[model samples]
Structure formats: structure tokens, C-alpha cells
Target: MQVNLPTNLLRSFVAIADTGSIVRATDKIFLTQSALSLQMKRLSEIVQVPLFRREQGTLVLTVSGERLLDLARRILELNDQAVESLDSVGLNGPVRIGIVQDFGDEILSGVLARFIQLNPGAELQIRVGHSREIRELFATHLIDIAVYHSVERDEFTVAPARMVWLGDPRLADRETLPLAFMTKPCLARDCAIAALEGAGRPYQLIVETSNISALRVAVEAGLALTCRSSAFTGHRLPAVELESLSLPTYFIAVMTLPSAHAAITGLAALITEAIENIVSPPFDLATDCPIKETEDA
Candidate 1:
């Protein structure tokens, strides 16, 4: 008989690996601790090997579990894709959206995938650049909706976010820190500089480019330290803690014209939902989202 692992088991396994705690994974998988434990037990019986082991009072994946985790993600991804594709509607029309690069690429990818699956006929035109440029595009009616990072809570505040220093470990050893950042109008860069200057820390700009990828490369290569929203920082460019480097809180905002279409509103809601999911500590999806009116043309 061919061995078949249930989808729910894979989901529970992935949640456990991602969260590192069965208790935390319970909230994500919506399973009681005992129920999730049963699922894991069933998975191990199917695979005929222990999937996870305890280490320092935390759940750590066994070697077999590590290998299975990759397969599990791919399977779940395909499963989700097929379901969405089959359920997609034939809604059509253009929906132009502008977003800043930092959190835009990561968060919006999943959000856009869902939106596109639901509205298969909708033509999406995405413009990625500085938040100021994106705001200009929306102001000129060149885009239907705009999402960007900002320090101001003026009208477009979608949710509260924060800028944090991220760098390779070796960067900390240097007396004069090397910094990587984009051009002007970058909130992370501004916050990073403000904190460093306020502390009177010595630093030099080693990489200055408008490309986020370049900044990431510079940081990962230990060329310089870069700052990004806590939403965007990860194991690739882990957050670096410095006693003197206190940064400012950043905000995610959406801009829409006065007479925006229904699609724009729908997309805005989807984007807000996506942000809430990715942000740490979970922002209130309903209360934090305040739709601000754009200035008249």
C-alpha cells in the first residue's frame, strides 16, 4: 500500500516548524494542543519516523522532518493555487496600484495572488518606486490606488509599523559602522541616520542605491548596515540590536482618489488584510484601517 500523508498533518507540521512551539502553532493551525499532537503523531506513523524532537524545551525538526518540511510547503502551495484557480471569477478591468519597495514586494505578492485569483479578468499594473513617487502617481490619477511607508499619520494611515536596524553579525565589530541605504525619501534610511546621529556614532555610507535588493546584498555581504520596517526584516538580514540605536515608528498607508472605483476599495481592503497578517503582534484589521480621502484635482 502506498503511504499517504494527510494535508492537515502537513499544515500542522509546517506551523510547528515556523513557530517553534506547539502552543503557538495551535493558534495558527486552529487546533487544540492535544489535537495538534495527534496530527503530528499520525504523520510520524505514516512516515515511520519521528518528525520533530525537543531541544532546550523547544520543538526542533528532526533531519527527516527538515527534508519533509520543504516538500510540505510545495505541496500546500500547489494545493492552494489549484483551489484558487478553480474558484476564480471572470471579473475584468484595469487596476493600477503603486507601492513602495520595502514591504511591497513581500506582502503584496500573496495579496495580489489572492486578488488576481478572485478577479481573473482584472488587468493589474503595478508600479514600484519611492513612496513619494508612488504618491505622485496616485495624485496625478496615473494609478488607481497607492500603498507606501510613511512616518506621517496624516490621512492614509493603514497601520502602525517600525523601522529597525538589520545587519550581518560581523558589521558590529567595526568601530565606524558602514551603512547601506537608498536615496532620499526613504523612511528607514532617515530613521537609521537620525538614531545614529543622535547617538553621535561614527558611520559611512558604503552603498547608496535606489534598489532594495542592492541594499539587501550590501547588508548580507557585511558591507553595511541597513534599516527596514520590522515587517520586512528576517533571518536573511536579521535585526541587530544596539543600545544607542533607537529608531522611529513607521506607518503603512494607502492613498485613494476621491471618486475611486469599487475595485480600488476592494484592493485596499485586501492589502490592509495582508499587512495585518504579516505584521508582528497582529494589528487590528478593522480598527487600524482608516480610508483617507485624496485632495481634489
Candidate 2:
């Protein structure tokens, strides 16, 4: 039987195999588990071979799956190269993008790498700082695009991130939690403090720096705990054990001015597409994560 597999399906297959779990794979591919499963099923039907086998609670590739892996990767490489070569024609000039420090360090490198690979001639000026500063850069027209987290629904949201407490385990048992965070104009800091106060839980700000690196250092050294998105914190630090601590959801958003040039707009679309593929899955393109043009607010 002739076999035909879509590029997206192959991408999902490669992601699932690489990540080793549906949850982590979904996060990498930015697809719902159901959606991913559906793609797998369709691929299997086309190939007439089982691709995955459950072994000791792990998803293992079948022999056929293993054989297809190499082919799939090569095909995808060629496909993407052709697409980039075609799409990148005449796409030149610098694209200034501002991003929050925490989120910037996590996804910026990979995002920019892919973008640069596609637009080889394009120049990238990446400015990393606090979310407030990033927003200010956008407002001043210093940046063509801005990626930051917000509590308010004023911008084009890319995804919803769960805010959680993270710190060294040694500091998790404190009666009055020691907080380490960026100074004023930080939504996560404000949200964490509000939650603690609302729960009548005592806490103190032990470290208030202008960046996430210092906050991360403090948290890693058992100096204090801080609130950040799972996207930002990842599993690098343990989540602070606090049954009483309730935090708010943060929106990872893309901000662009209405007067942005076509190149800026195209770059923004690339960013949106890249973010959708990299962020944790179960995203709804219609409501949960709206990737559209919006005026800077």
C-alpha cells in the first residue's frame, strides 16, 4: 500500500519519541493529547504498522516506527528547508524583539535560532529585561515585537501559564516564607504577595532584584522562594510545598504596534507559530491562546 504522511504528523511522531511522554511531547509540539493521538492513529493507518507499544508504562517505538524515524526526519528537514527558502525570499532587515528575562532565556534562543535559519539574511536585536521594561521598550517603539506575561487581557495572548511557587527544598519549610523576586512592576511578585496576604500566610521579601537570574540564584541557594510560571521555572527547582498558597494564571502574550511594518508583522507571525509549537499543549487556538494582531496597550 502506498504511504502518505503529513509533515505535522511526522513532527508529532518525532516529538513524542524524543520527549518520552505524552505530556512532555504535547508540551513540545503544542497540541492537545487528543490531537496528537489522532495524528498518530492516522499515520499508523497510512503506514499499516503499529508505531508505538506500551512497555512498562512507557511508550516505546515498534520496529517499523524505528525505521520510519530516520526517513521522517530527513523528509522533514528537506520539506522545511524548501519552505524556508521559498518563504524567506526578499524577507530582510532587522526585527527588534523584547522579551521578559525569565521567559526569554527559556524559549528565546530556540525561537530565534529557528527564525534565523528560515530568514538567513534577517538581523535580530533581542532585548531581555523585566516584563515591565520589555513593555516599556514596546511602548517607546524601540521593539517591533514584545513577548511578556500579563494578568490583564489587554494584549494578544500566546498561552496561559500556571504560576507556582519555586525554591530550594531547604527553604520550603519556613514559617514566614522568604520571597525573592524582581522589584516593582512585576505581576508575579504582586500576585504572589496578594495570594499570601489573602491566605493570611506570612512572608517577607528577602531579595528584590531587577532580573530573574538573581532571583533564581537566591531560590537555588535556599535563600528564598518566588512565584513564576511553570514555563519559566520548569523542573529546575522544586515547587515550594504550600497547600495554602494559591496563585493566579499568567498570559504569555505578543505585543505589536498597529503601525508595525510588514516585515515586523511577518516576523510576529513566525514568532506566534514558533511559540505555539513549543509551549505546553492542550491549547485552544480560538480562546485560550489567541495569536492575532493587536494594538499595543
**Best candidate per TM-score, number?**
1
lDDT of 2 at 72: 93
Model 2 C-alpha lDDT versus the unseen true structure: 0.75
The C-alpha local distance difference test score for the whole of candidate 1 amounts to 0.76
**TM-score to true structure, per model:** 0.62, 0.60
Alpha carbon deviation, residue 261, candidate 2 (Å): 5.1
Candidate 1's residue-wise lDDT over 212-235, tens digit each? 777777777778888887665543
After superposing candidate 2 on the true structure, give the runs of residues whose Cα lies further than 4 Å from its correct spot.
1-90, 258-263, 277-297
RMSD of each: 16.6, 16.4
Model 2: per-residue lDDT, tens digit, 1-297? 665687778978998888777777754454678988899999999888999998998889999999999999999888646544564363454467887776666567676777777667666667777678788778867677888887765648877766788877666577888888888888888898888888888888889998677777888788888888665554576566687777766777898877655556766787777666655543563466435555999
